[model samples]
Structure formats: structure tokens, C-alpha cells
Target: MESAFTKYTPTEPQIPPMCITLTKFLTTRIQETYNVCKRENPTNIKNCLTNPFEARHNYGLDNERNELIVYRHDIIGTFNSFEGKEFSMSPYTISRYEVIEKLGQGTFGQVFKCYDHINNRFCALKILKNKKAYLRQGLLECATLSMLNTYFDSNNDRIVKMYDHFMYCDHLCISFELLNQNLYQYAKERRHIGLELNDIQKKLIQLLEAVECCSKAGIIHCDVKPENILMTENGELKLIDLGSSCFENYTLYSYIQSRHYRAPEVVFNNRYNNAIDMWSVGCIIAELFLGVPLFPADSEFDLIVRFVEMLGMPSDEIIKNGKIADRYFKLVKRTNKYRLKESFEFEWENNIKLPPHKNYLYYSSLHDVIMKNPMKLSLNTKENNFIIRECLLDLLQRILVYDPKERLTPNQALNHPFFTFKNINDITPKDFYEWTPPEREFPFKVYGHSVSADPEDMLSDAFENKIIINKKLTNSEYYNVFFTLLQAGHVANITIDNPFEYGSITPKQFIRVFNHQFSKPSIPKVSTDVPRSFVAQIYSVTDSFNSVPIKKEENPLTIKHCNQSKIIIHRMTDNK
Candidate 1:
């Protein structure tokens, strides 16, 4: 599609209306030119003035012949004494790029879709404005791009890759890999319909990975709204626009991030870290699910109020640390409690007439907002859908934490339960193949790996359909295993050859063997209930816990098995 800006015709330069007066200022200079069209021999041109100022007009003087001699196209373009901030049009070449059309415009400069003659491919050429401050910012963008493109973005897929950068027509032009529409445009094209849960999950995984990459480089992507994330044809997201980015330790601006996605620390002008990006990520995820921004505010004050409504009030410590906290909050002298200053009262302090607060729909917490969202999940059962929502909400709560120090890091979010397949039925072939196993933990060493007693690291994906023996399972864990197995198609007989001296088994001794021989295939579900006689043989009649077990009186619940389509576990043997 053509840009909204008027196309500049070669015959008439599309200068701004305000610049029209400059033509009269340079009229005397233009009149000094000789009419080459009226020469004794038209081929032999007479002296024509080539003053820099006359170039703004498309043609040289033809007062005598009253016809054009030197067309604007005849002269070679130079940077010296350029008039407007942007290049005129395509059919124009800047260095090796053949400018096709204007793609976009930002504070730094205008971006054009150009043909890279050398590479024989299309690229986005970002040409900085011919102004000092913009040029400086553009150069900084180039440096950050150079660092990321060289060291961090080794895959060339996480972030928008920069190809070449150079000065063209006195503008610092940086060429980047051309990508599809940004996320904002993508959602808009879909009429603001929320994305599918699976799609949102996939995008979040990639987005978090991208953010983690940025964190590794110690660069803060000061602006990370939907507009800054571009979707490839395959639907993979690539982060773009790091013009406002700065090193984590050397943040250049207190005012950063889009209003809706802005972190609280930024809103209060407090010291922020990489956690600010996580907050933005949380907002984006919420928006992706709701088909709109999580917090759409007309002003910073409104944004703070939304934050308060959606995520409770910030801790006193957090508010106290804010550099500009006094602008929005006042410390009560008697109680030392911070109170939100009224918007009208701040008008005098800031010398700006502030609008009255708009009545906003209130949510007790982010959980309430997410629960209210009409999210459609692929799960067949409502219970499964609710489970997914709750898992996602847990992750978002940590990400949207008011305190930067307590907010979830990209690495931590990657490990959140939402990304893991808690249900066997939810496990896709893709999920299995792409699954990364966490470090294992057990009381004793297994598979040449060190052992730890920590219960948190003990459970892995393979142990989802686990068997608990003398060790009674908690209600939550028991139900989790039951539901997981209930979804499985086949039940395999798991036999234990030997048990400890006490003739008892515990989860800590449940060695996870990655042997491929014990592949479990899904078949059909077994009966939900069994006779007491049948239950007695499989499970020990224990008063402490209520669990169904397979009958094996001689065997003391030694083998823990999973009901799965492909359950591969090798039997563990003790060394003599």
C-alpha cells in the first residue's frame, strides 16, 4: 500500500507549505541563471547558475526561451544545503539501495523499502533525519544493532537483523531485514480478535527468549510495545526498534516505554532494570489474550491508577524510591503512609491543567482481569481450560509484580508451569520433541548425576504420571497424577525386582530412566472404580492416604510407571 504522505512528483518538489516562502527568498539567485534552451545552438548551453539554493526548485531559469532546459532529474543529488528532513521519492538511489517506497517513519528517521543491488534482495532502509539530535540517536541505534547483530543474535531470528549501515545524502542510513507487519497491525487486521491460546503460548515463548537475549547483552529495549514486534510470514515474532535502548547500567532517559506497556518504575521515574521489559511483556501477553491493551490510560496518572487497581498498591519501599513519587503521592505526616495525590491538586505543582480522573472499570487484581477475559482454549474439558488459564495467570502475576526486584525474570518465566505440559493429553508431538528436561534431583546419585534432596527440583516431565508408594502423595499431587493417567490411553504393568531393607519405596528413590525400550503406548481408559477385593491386591490399605494402586501383594510398590502414549523408562538396578 502507498504511504499516506503525498507523493513527491519530479516536476514539482513536495516541499512543505511553510517552506514555500523560501522560493521567493531564492528568486534572485534563480533569475541569475542563463536560459540554456535559448542558446544560439541549443546543444551548446550558456552559463547557468548552479547555486545550492536553486536545487530546491525542480528546474533552472528559462526566462528567454520560456521553456525548461535543466530538469531537476539532470543534477546529481548532494547533501549540502538540503531543504526537507526526508528524501523526496523512489526511482531514487541512496548508495547501493534503490529506494522503492516509504515504509514507515519514526522520531529517528523515515524507513524506505529498498532493493539492495549488491545482495539482490529487498531490505528496509532507515534513513535518519538531517538533524543533529536525530543523527546522534540514529548512530546510537546503529551501535546497539551492531553489537546485537554481531554477538547476541547468532541465530539471526530472535531480533531484526541489521545488514548494512552508512552515510547516504548526509543521513545515517541503516538497512535491516525487511519483515512483515508489526503485531499491532496484525491484531488490527484481525479486527482485534484475541489470538488462540496455542498461538499466544508460542509467541510468548519466543518473545521471552528474545527478551532474555536482550538481557544477556545488557541492553534495555526501552520501548517494547506491539508496534515494536514484527511477525514473520511463518508467524514467528522478531523484536524491532531499539533506538531508545541503552545499556542497563547507563540508562539514557527516565521517560521510556509506551504508556500502556510502561513499567511502574519508569512511570515514577525510579531506577529500573531489565525487569521493566518483563512488565512490558506481561502487558503484551495480556493484550494478546484480551484483544486490547491491559492498561489503556490517557495519562501517566491514569496509568498509575490502573496499576493500582490491577495489581494492588506498590509497596511503601517501591514508592519511596521513586524519584518523582511526590508528583503522584504524598506522605501523610502522622501515619507515614503514602496517599495518591488528586489529579486536580497536581495541576498547580506541574503548572499544567490536569483533567479530572476518568471513571475506570475496577479489577481486584490482574487475576480478576485475566479470568474475565473470554479466552478460548484447545482443551476439550472446561477443567483443562481453567487449569491453563490459572497457569498463565500465575506467570503474569509474577511478571507484573510492582517491585522490579521481585518481578519474574525471562529465565524464570521460561520455567513457569504455563510452558510445561502438565497433562498428557495436552502434550503434542511437537511439544515432546522440543521439550527441554530440567536438571534431575534425588536423594542418591542416579545416572552419574549429583543428587539433591530439594523437592522442587525432584519432579521432571517424565514423572508426571508417577507412582507414590509408602510416601503418601499430597492431595494436589495425587489428583495431578490421577488426571494425567486418566487421560492416558494405555496402562502398562510396572514391576519392581527389589526393594530397600524396609520393603518400602519413596519418590526420592524413584530413579528416572531414559531407556527407550520401555515405550508406553496409549490405548483406552480403564474402569474408574474397582471392587475392594481388587483394590486390596494393588494398593496397600493405608489409613494415611486414599490412592488406587495395582495389585501386587508380594511387591512393595517399588516401580513407578506413567500412563502415556510413549512411556520409556528403564528399570533401575543397584550395584553390588
Candidate 2:
């Protein structure tokens, strides 16, 4: 009998001593049991002896945790059972909060007023949808909100306060202080029947104070339109909608301003800073007084034109430093056909038109309407032509300057006499809200709602409104291709009529001919170091003044200086 214990030899050297001791103890017990049961039955004694060892082995196997511990050889010492920590439910996740009403939907989220169940407070909860398309936009909104929340955390009265942010499964909830209504709705309701000058001054002061708060924090509310300015129930002006806002040092690669209130520098593709906000503030002021946008052009180009029409074109020196100098200057329409050939002359009566609306009656159209006006309060009291003409028109004109750098800053506007009133802070919210107008009942239905109005239609309308001006200006046959090349900064000029050809040519042949005309000057050097032949080949394809066929071998040497010059000139000349 080969022993069954032979196969059960200790596998680990460290456990050999313990295994031997256990085996000895088990054998002694088995021998005693066998001796006691020898007279009864030899087979029964053998079975009883093996059964004790087997039962002991089975008991060790029954404890899985203990078995793993024993396998680790106790090198890690004693094992303690782990218990998970208890987590409390988020306050927002509770279903006890009462939903009062929906506020308005933002670009990627919807806002609603809800009563907090935990705190029993009224708060506005902005629910952000985790949609794939708006992921980046949603992130931007969160970043902006978090930044603003940190900055305004200390100030409670002047700024809208962010209460809490909670995550419920896939949704993110942003809680903020509940406010009454935005200035857009307020202004729309009170159009025509303007607020009393005293009340307006009070509101302006509150707005200025809010501006001061932002400026102190080194923030610029890039989007300062009426929709972003909110009115508290107390009539205090609070700046809201930090989604389009950024720090003073931040520069958005793309423009992020409302079209109507966009600064001229922004419209012209110029790099802008805090001054753009001032321009928006001016637009808001103009809207408040005149009941409409100051420069309501049909398109961006038209808007720029309207701005220039009101404030006059910027100086060449001003244009050069701006980002749009290379691109926009070429596109700006020149209307100054009245310049004198010899010396300067002024003819005020025939050239100037009476300032457009009733608002112009208080300011001089010439002095206060554009470049010359510096947004100051009208001091003239007389209703005579000179006084009436020198008052509001001039004041408003200074506010609407095309050059943002030249426009009145928020602080500067605050100090102006227009805002100088004894009881400026005394005006309450009830004064502005309670004094209702007849127009309050009639809301203008601007955007039509229909299932047919899909994203394609909206996109088409946007493209038509934004790009049609450029397209219409470039109506010549080669304008599209030529303009594209020009935008890329090439130096070639485009002519409508080819001096070498009399008949109309196809676009391909036109390119070939154009390429041939501007062919590079022949390289005189024959040194192998310069690759003169390769250079010449490259110049041959790119230097053409007409459309020309290009070969693969000559591609490396082709100068293909696309006619960026033509685009610039076309842009300059096309601004009708």
C-alpha cells in the first residue's frame, strides 16, 4: 500500500515544518483510534481515522476568506473585512422640490424656477442636456459659470448668485438666484413711452455699478445686450448670462457678439477687447432712448456701413493697427466722393440730413452724431434749432462711434452729466416696472414657429444674411476663385479683360493664361546648390498671370502666388 499521504507533500519550503507537525498529530490520533477499534473491526477503524483528517480538510476549504489568507502565508499579517462608506443623497436629487414655472431655454440648456425642498428657498435651476452635438458648448457654459461663481461668490446684492451645482445621473443641475426679467423684455414692454429721466438715471447708475463690479474683477461681459441685463424685483440691475463673457486676458478665436450690438471692430474681423462691451452698452442706451437699434442694418457689411454713416470712417492709422485692416479695409465702401481737389471746404446745409428720429431733436447732427461727438449730456435748454440740434443727436452719436477704441468706456459714460442726478439711486424697481405703457400688451412676433422651419432653412437664412453681401460684390466670372486666392495673401492682380485675349475663355484656360502671364523672372544662377532648374519649374506653374495647366514635375518649383492682390483690390472697390 502506497500511502495516500505521499501525494500530499508540502509544496512550499516555509510550510514544511507546520505540515510535518500536523501530520504527526494526525497519525498519533489515528493510531490511538485504530488501537481502540482494533478488536471491533480493522476496516471500520481505518475509515474512522481517515474521516477525521478528511473532515478537517473540508472544514478549512469551507472558509474561502481564511483559505486565501492562509495561501498568502500571513506575510501581509491579519486581514480586516472592508465595508463601504454610506453616502447621503444630494438635496437636488430629492423629489420634494416644487417646480413653479419654466424660465427660458438657453443654447444648450433649459432654466426653471424651483422651490428647494431642503432649504425651502426659491432658486432657478438650469438643467443641461448631455447631448453629443452640444458637448463642447455645454463645457464652455460650465467653465464660464464656475469662473463667475468664484468671482461673485462674495458679492450678493449686485450680482446674480450661484447657489449650488449637483449631478443627477447624466444631468448637471446649476442652481442660481431667481431674478424677475431681462432688460430686453422690460424695454420691449416700455418702448415709445420712455422711462422718466430720473428713473433712467437710477437704472443707469445700477448698471454702471454692476459694470464696476465686473471691471474690478477683471472680467468683460462681451455680450452686453439687453437680454443679458436682468432686473431684480427690487429694480436693481444685475448682469447675467456669463456664457458669452470672459476674463480681460481671454481672447475668443471666433466672434461671440450679438449681430445688432456687435462692435465695428468685431464686424470688420478686428481683434477686440473690453471696448466692445462699451459699444454694446451704447447700443443698449440708444435702444432705450430711441426705441430701436441705433444701426439696424440688414447685413454685417451694411451694419458697418451704417456705423460709418453715423460715426464716419475710421482713420487709416486706426485701421492699420486693427486686425481687419488687411481684410476689411479692402471691403469698406468709400462714400467720400465730395473731397475737395485743392483745399478743404465745409458745406453743412446740403450735405447733412436732419438726424433721423425724434431722438435727434435734442442734439446737433453734425457735432454730436459721429466721429466728433463724445457722448456727453446735452446742456442746451433752448428749443431753438441750434440748441435742439446740438443736444441728444450729438450725445447719442458719440455713444455709437464705430471705432471701439474711440467709444466711451463704461466708467466714462457713468461720469457723464446725463447720469448726473441728485436722486439717481432713489429710483426703485417699482418705478420702472409699474409705469406700464400701451405697447406692453402687444408683443412683436418676430420669429415664426412652424414645423417647416427646420435647421436647414435657418442656416440658409443665416448664410444669406451673412455671406450674400460678399457674393453679390464679387459677381465677375473669376471673382470667386480670384477672391479666394486673394484672401490667402498672394500678390497677383486680376483684370476683368485679358490684354492678350479678345474672346471669352473657359475658367481652366483663364487660369492657364493667367499663370503664363505672371511667370517668374528667369533664374540667372546655374549653381547646383540653389536647384535653379527646380526653382524655375516651380515659378513657371505659379508665376502665370493666366490659367495654365500644371505638371506634377513642376509642382515643387511652382510659385503659384494666387492673386490675393486682386481680392484686396476687389474688396476695396466692391464696397458700393
Candidate 3:
């Protein structure tokens, strides 16, 4: 995927004949608007260009002027489109576009690679799954894209371009410009060698820029993983998938984000905000450097333990405010009253040790973990490298804070030295230059279709369920081992305990056990730093709050309170 545009010799963007008419109308309309606005206020055009929230393009018949005028919205490059397009009966047919092949499927629905028959160009079509209730979600995506489309630069547009959307066969179909691939796939190819730190930083700049634009738009992209970011031929990054986005005025969904990118607030079911995205950004940035997920956990509890190992327990305010803190953390009254809960956890975890698991946080620190592992930080081993290592960790800490209120916003992040840093090593040797197709913008660069993708393909391959049948144990036998674990000073629901009572638990049964856990897990620490925010399409079903048929409580674990500091789970017996 090579660029097609070069300075003044930019490639002519592909547009259907009808779109040409719309473009003319839009251009005339914009000129008229500028003329009228300039007569009233001299700085109107400048404001329109600079004001990110300002409306960029408006399409309508100019009844006042007795003519139809359209102001073309030139995003990364220039693109022209017409609204209210009608498609044929075929699912693949959408106006003048023909479906090529299915590109991918996501939480929103299926995305197809399509060709614009009229323009002889390729585009992507997102066909909303036919659900009457999900129409609102489609509309939310429309609103978000509309806001993003107008906020554009010649080649600096961050979000994917949405050309048009329409209803067909009871399903909402959206047409977007076809992209090359995504960051996830791109990163996977080079995970072993990994991307240069400078290149990684550049990618973050593009992603964070998109994030900042969302903040300016007053929208939250609840999901912000590598899979959602597309990379173009010219190395342009575009953020896609807005089905879960919501406005700042209200939250739509409570349960949001994928397992790995999930913020502490999301895991705890606490009140969340834009900070959630920042935490994900931190995770993404680390992966870009390490070529793997920063914290890849088998279970949610394991992720919490990783946090404890790196950063220690979250602040007391985080624990208290968390909606489901009891599900993971055991809040014991302190014997040392003078020490704050957070301070005590940090100090005692680092100092005191009574047995095999006296304090969880004592296991390792951020420096120890990175120094032990093979990361970008581990590559540089000079004693003077502490400053650079701290620089990298400092950036991670700012974004991965437990309290969303304290997390670094995209605005603050862009100013951080990590993004602004210019490495001396970036300069290439005069004789050793890497050559490629010349950097030129393509005909489709700005109009339709989009960037690349970065999905976690290796995530599935990370674990192997290879049990060699070393011994055959009954369900009762498995339960007996767990019972013994509980009897020997093990705690259920604590981050330390593996809560799988049996060898198998269905998603429903797992949720049930998770909902019942007493000791809560603290938000994972980011080596002492992050917060997260989310915009939801539907936080939860309205009926989730309604009355339900009550059933006898299922006590999976029978525990007796030994005291405020201790509890005992009675062993399971093979009784007749």
C-alpha cells in the first residue's frame, strides 16, 4: 500500500457523478456561508477551521438563496458524498457500491470490503446486525463520525471516514473507505523484532490524537484497543468502531471494554469516565514496545495480582468507591491505626512476611519485573539508564492510575516528554538508507476505505490446555484438593486464591461466582500509576434493574468468620 499523493501533484480522489454535483453545491454553499459570516465577523473562517467542535460540512437545499449548495468536507484529503442513497434488494448491494468480501466482524457487526461501481474504487461497508433496538447504537456511531469527519487536516485526520449510511432490509448499512490493515496485525508480524521505539511513539501520537479529538467531540469511545485502529498505506492511523461510544452528558453501558484493556473501574463496576480509555492507551503503548500485551492474565483475578506485583494496592478511596470491591479485597481493620489503608498495604506488603503469602505486593516491583523480563527497558542496561527507564515507566503510571479522576487526559498526555521526545538514534546513517515506494497519498487516501488493524492474534495461542492425563481425578477429588487449599489458610475471592471450584465453569456459572466473591481485588497498579473512561451504547438492559423470581441461594463456598482478620471455609465432604 504505497501513497498516491505528492505535494502539489496530489492524486485525484475518486467520487461518483452524483457526489460531484453534491461537492459543487457544498463548495458554493460554503463560500456563501463564509461570505455572509465574514460580513458579520472577520474571524469566522479561522474559527471554523480551528474550532474542533465547529460543524465542517452541511448538505441541504438552499431555499433562502433558491439553489442547492454543498460545502465539501475535506478530511485527510478531500472526499465528496451524497446522502439518502437507496440500495437494491441484495445484501451486497448498497447504492452504487458492490460487496467484495467480508473484511472482519466486531462487536458492532460484520464489515465487508466493497467496490464503488460508479467510482471504480474500493470501500468498506459495516452492516449493522438486524436488531430494532440496536438502531440507536447505529445512530450514535453516525453522530460520532459526523463530528470526526469535519475535524480534518490534509493528512492528519485520525478517525475513519464514514461516507454514508442507510437502512436496507431492516438493517442499517454504513459505507466507509476501505483501509489497508489494522495495528494489531501490523504489530504481530514484527512482535519478535518489535517496532522501533520512535515508530511506536509515532503510532501513539496518531492514536492519542484521535482520542483527543473524541474528547473535543464530547464523545467517549468505550472500546480503544489495537484492533480498532487502522493503519493506511501512507502510515496514517484511523480509529474505528463507534457502536459503543456515548456522549459526555450520560453513560449508556456499565459493562464495557474487552478483558485485557479493561480499566480497574470497569473490573470493579465503579463509576467510570474518559480515564478508562487512557488506561487502555497505556496498555497499548506498552504492547507496541514489547510486542505483547503488557499485562496478559488468564483470569481477571490474575490481572489484579499482576497489578499488585507491580504497583501494590490501590488507594483506599478506590477500594471504598468500587461497586464490587468485596468481590476481591478483604478490608481488614488495621492493627496500625496511624498507617493509612493504602500506606499500610504498601509498607506491610514490602516489609512484613509471616508465611508463604504474608503480603502479595512484596513479590516484585516494577523495576524488578522489567529488569527480569525482556522488554524495551531491559534492552538498555546501563546504570545511567535509570532516568530513561523511569521516563518510560512514568508515562505508563500517569495513564494507568486506579482513580479515573487522577488519570492523564489525552490533552495532558500529548504534552508529556515521551510523546515530544526526539531520539538521536532516529537519524539514519548517510550510506545505509532504507528505501521504499515513495511517500504519496493515494486516490482513496482521504475519501473512502482506511488504515490497518492491530489485533491480538497470539492472545489465543498464549495458553495451551495441554493436560497429559498424568492422573485421572473425579469431580469430587478436584473439589477435595480445593477444600484442602481453603483449610490450609487459603482465602476465597482474594486475588491470591484461584476461585475455580471445579475444573470447569461455564460463563454463566463463572459470572455467578464472581458476583458472589467477598474479598475484592484492587485495581491493578501501573508500577504506581492510571484511570479509565467509557461511553456505553447500553450500559445494561433496563430489565436488569427489575424484580426477578427469587431462588434459594446457592452457596458454592461455606465460610465461617474466624475474626475481622481471618475467615475459614469448611471442607467439602463426599456425603451420602
- TM-scores for every candidate against the unseen true structure: 0.58, 0.47, 0.53
Find the candidate with the highest lDDT and give its number. 1
Better of 2 and 3 by lDDT: 3
What is the lDDT for 388 in model 3?
Answer: 46
Q: Could you give the candidate ranking by lDDT, starting with the highest?
A: 1, 3, 2
> Could you tally the backbone clashes for each prediction?
6, 38, 56
As a TM-score, model 2 comes out at 0.47
Q: State model 3's lDDT.
A: 0.50
Q: How far out, in Å, is residue 557 in model 3?
A: 58
TM-score-best of 1 and 3: 1
Give the range of the ten consecutive residues with the poorest summed lDDT in model 2. 77-86
Best first by TM-score, ranked: 1, 3, 2
Flag regions of model 2 displaced more than 4 Å: 1-98, 131-153, 322-328, 331-399, 423-576
Worst 10 residues of 1 by lDDT: 491-500
TM-score of 3: 0.53
Q: Pick the candidate with the highest TM-score.
A: 1
lDDT of 2: 0.43
RMSD of 3: 28.0
